[model samples]
Target: MVLGWRRRKNNNHKGVKQNVEVIVPNHFMCPISLDLMKDPVTLSTGITYDRQNVEKWFDEGNCTCPVTYQIVRNLDMTPNHSLRILTQDWCVENKQHGVERIPTPRIPVSRFDVAELLIQVKASARGLDQYGCLELVHKMKRLGNEMERNKRCIVENGAPGALASAFDAFANDSIERNVNVLEEILSALNWMFPLKLEAHKYLGSKASLTCMVWFLKQQGLSGKEKSIVTLKELLSFGDEKHVEALSEIEGVCELLVEFINKRISPTITKASMRVVWYLVSSSSPCSDKMKLAFVELDLVSSLLDILIESEKSLCEKALAIFESLCSIEQGREKGYSNYLTVPLLVKKILRVSALTTEYCISSIWKMCKLGEKDDEKRVIVEAFHVGAFQKILLVLQVGCGDKIKEKATELLKLMNPYRAHLECIDSDYKNLKRSF
Candidate 1:
């Protein structure tokens, strides 16, 4: 009887283990949200899951049964759908708004109120605390949006002169005060309404540029400081039309030239280079002041130096500036060779070869094109230290298989006629022709 009882107990234990092996397909839900396991947070007890405890999860390309811990084969448990659902819910909760969301006072607020708001925005930005600035940016964004929607109301009825008057006051205030406010507004708008049409309406306007330049000049910003000011302020000042007024400033060109000469921080120097490029690209009448500035600053050499040191983007801008300069009728005159000549340009091109692949190719293409156009073919021949044909043959030999080589080859064929003066070409023509 004792042996029979022990055998029965063992059978019962085996039966209980079999029952435990039975798997449930959907046995549990997250307690917090009552949804399928999201962030399946584990606990210290090793038996419970919680939402707050979980950071994130990955399926590893298969689903594991919550109860039996068996991997579900041939199941597409990629988790992409789960992530989308979570993100969609998160966005909706964060962006949902009500009618009374606007924060401006019902009554018209005074200029001082705007000034105070601007000060707070500046303080928040200076601290570099994103959360601290968020509230102020939201408020400004709401105000700017409201003003735009009611633009017809303000401009036509003139009911609330307060906001318009405040803007005018800010625009005409002392340089330091006005610029500080403008900077704050710009920063706030950039953050709060990035890519919003209302943001463009608020920030991109002629009035803004007028005010900004006035403030910049009043602060006596020039050279690197002026470059920085332009760099930070241009996008907020709208598009190409706004550039006209800024470009017309007496010292603006000189400031750009100084920026190029002093080797300002690459960021500021790049910005200054862009400003010059736009000015030249527009085909605006070249002012005597601009020319004199370029001459005084020795802009050609400075630009070449930048081409040698800067990355491809800056080098591209520098090349564009060079092209624009050459496009002007006066730029094509004989005397201009004093600034841009075959020897100096060749040296600069060689220096650029070490900078970037795009820059090196561009420099080579420009040099070859210049050779084809130059009236002084002797200068090109002398500068390359070989006969024109030999130079072309050497370029073909050392070519890197970039598109620029093709362009260089085309220009070489054009300049080959000038090779009649070279002794090497006469002796090597048959061999060169065979190779070609």
Candidate 2:
């Protein structure tokens, strides 16, 4: 019921001249909320609901009209400025009643304005004095949060390219040898890092990627964490060329291994593992290079240490990376050098979670399942050295997932024939879990 239907306390109402209850108009109410619409917007279904309500629906992954329950082919919500004007005006005229006036909504930044800002930023970044560029970038970051529309506008307008070039300029500029300033630039870039498409192009710039890799090697954990996360984001979308570029960056694998060795934070360890996984998993030219890098850097030792020291989730990630490191001959030698790896896998198998069993089984299986009968005999002997043979017996007894059980059973059969030829003790297996 509109206030237009209010009782005639006096003849002040211009058109309404009836004695009735003061009520709000039904059209003013949001269909979803059953409350008066504030900042009304029209959906593609031609239904007008409160802007906040409709947007909340969309953000929650609902794709249909709240009223019609029909698929919203175009999810765009156009602001019902005219209806909003009427709603606000009605509230103002009904001040004698308890209705509060709806305040005017702030306008979101337009796409054209965002593009114009990007143009200004590109021009300022190219200039010798980057003060203007930094200032403009700060503005862009602020504008980016103002609306999702602005975020899309920023990416579409080539904000990633502009900001990436600016990042390189900041790093190499002699006039501004300020790490804090570079951090600010990187931090601002974080806003778009998670959302931007073709992001590897930004990260692949020569001086810039090198600077980030070197930054990862430095002491500050905060800086390294941010760099790792940004690197992971880029690698998530990285293609063959980016992988090669990453492989070419000196000290990248070494620093990643260093971060894992430090074991300061679960987040840091996971980030490092993700980088290693992406490089190895996205194999092309980088697979062999990355596997060799893992061996050359002696990551096997650090990753092994993490298996013992970290929590369940972190241990799972470490195990995963270790699995990759041992997949190749060089990687296998690196693991063979680390006496703790086989023992650690034996200790952790079926102990962590079903998810980790795959990693542990694969690592242990890769260590033992050999092409040469001589290598098989060698690894089986090494397995006994670290009590791996006994642990395999325990996995058979404990009995985990079918795949894990099968893998353990296979290794057991291989070692069974050698059991009579070689020597082993039951007590070594019992205490092996406590070795780490």
Candidate 3:
């Protein structure tokens, strides 16, 4: 009876195997790539599978035949013998054809994007294992380099959308949590593409600027040290391409001046003053946007104030701005003269001589030229003091030449109503001649 039972079971198994072979197809193919399965791997979506990753698919409960899209049960693996033969044949054909199947490369993320990612990792660091957080931070640094490279490409191409997208990703990904990371990104961006038009576009866009300001505040950059650093970065390139964008940002110049005052460091103050000087000196027309920087930030007064307190180099820069303001025809057309007093400015000019004899002398000479009218002449006369006269005479005595001496004598005569000053100047001239 036992022998009879064993024979019946064997017959049943044979019948099941025959049925499985009849049902299963010999070959399977992927619809998308239209290639025989190399390593049939299942995707998280459950709909896609690669023949090359068949074992992985089965491990993940996705033991489905790629050709028929039928789920093959793990326990009934024996049923798919025909499919296996077909996969082996396909692999051999693929090797013969030299059809190399490479995985798609990931799109390189920007430094801005990596910064955003680092911010997220930093926020969650407390919860993550220390080693994991460290690893993420390291990954973020690598991503930052990729971002810098992409930004360089965008800058060269003049692609605002690419820059905007990069900034947007950064804003959405990282600016909210680790504000310092955003700062690092901004610093990097500022350094990499200091004059990129796309950066200006991003800065001008209300959304981007607002987000940046928010990030700045969060990073404790709202103060003068940070603000000045930011502005210096903006104006560092000193390129004509950046001028329009620099003018576009409302109150940037004034904010920069205010920052300089607050920060009060010689280096920072010097750099900030230089940027303002560059803007005024550049031939580009100052826009209402740029004028707004003066109006809102009281930049003129701030500049005058800086002239009062800053170091020699900073003072020279401020004086250059003054000189440009006085000389540019637009100053009168733009009614800048109406807003600022030449006489008060002249007094400030005289004060600069005490700071640097050469600078003050040069400034006075320029101021005298600006004094074209009688009223302007009278103002110059009243403002000029004996100290200024002595400096002018000293310059003349040192043999500044006939033209300078003539100008100085004329200026001196205007200042000295009585002829008593002439005796001192005549003495200095004789003394200089005697020495020579």
RMSD of each: 16.3, 7.2, 22.1
Best by lDDT: 2
TM-score of each: 0.47, 0.73, 0.43
Residue-level lDDT of model 2, residues 104-209, one tens digit each, is 7756566678778868876765673567776787788787777676776677767777677667766666423646556656776776766455345656666667
lDDT by residue for model 1 (1-436), tens = 0110011122465554221121112323443334434334343323233232221222233244343455434322222334334433543443422111112123333344456665665565455444444565456555555544222222223212222223334444443444544444444333232233333333334454455445434543332344244334444434554455566555667666766666546765776777676665553455334544464455665655554446667766776666445433344332244433433344444334533333333444454455345643444454444333444455557664656577556656655665565444222211121110
Better of 1 and 3 by lDDT: 3
Itemize residue pairs with steric clashes in candidate 2.
Answer: 1-23, 1-24
Which regions of candidate 3 are displaced past 4 Å? 1-180, 187-219, 222-227, 264-268, 287-298, 328-366, 393-436
Error of 1 at 388 (Å): 8.3
Deviation of model 3 at 408, angstroms: 7.4
Q: Which lDDT values do the candidates have, in the order given?
A: 0.44, 0.73, 0.47
Give the CA lDDT, 0 to 100, for residue 159 in model 3. 34
Off by over 4 Å in 2: 1-25, 42-47, 56-104, 146-158, 168-182, 193-197, 217-221, 280-293, 337-339, 353-355, 371-375, 378-412, 418-436
Q: For model 1, what is the alpha-carbon lDDT of residue 278?
A: 62
Query: Model 3: per-residue lDDT, tens digit, 198-294?
Result: 5555444444454554543434533334434544555555555456655565555655566556654665566666666666666667733344444
TM-score of 2: 0.73
* By TM-score: ranked, best first: 2, 1, 3
How high a TM-score does candidate 3 get?
0.43
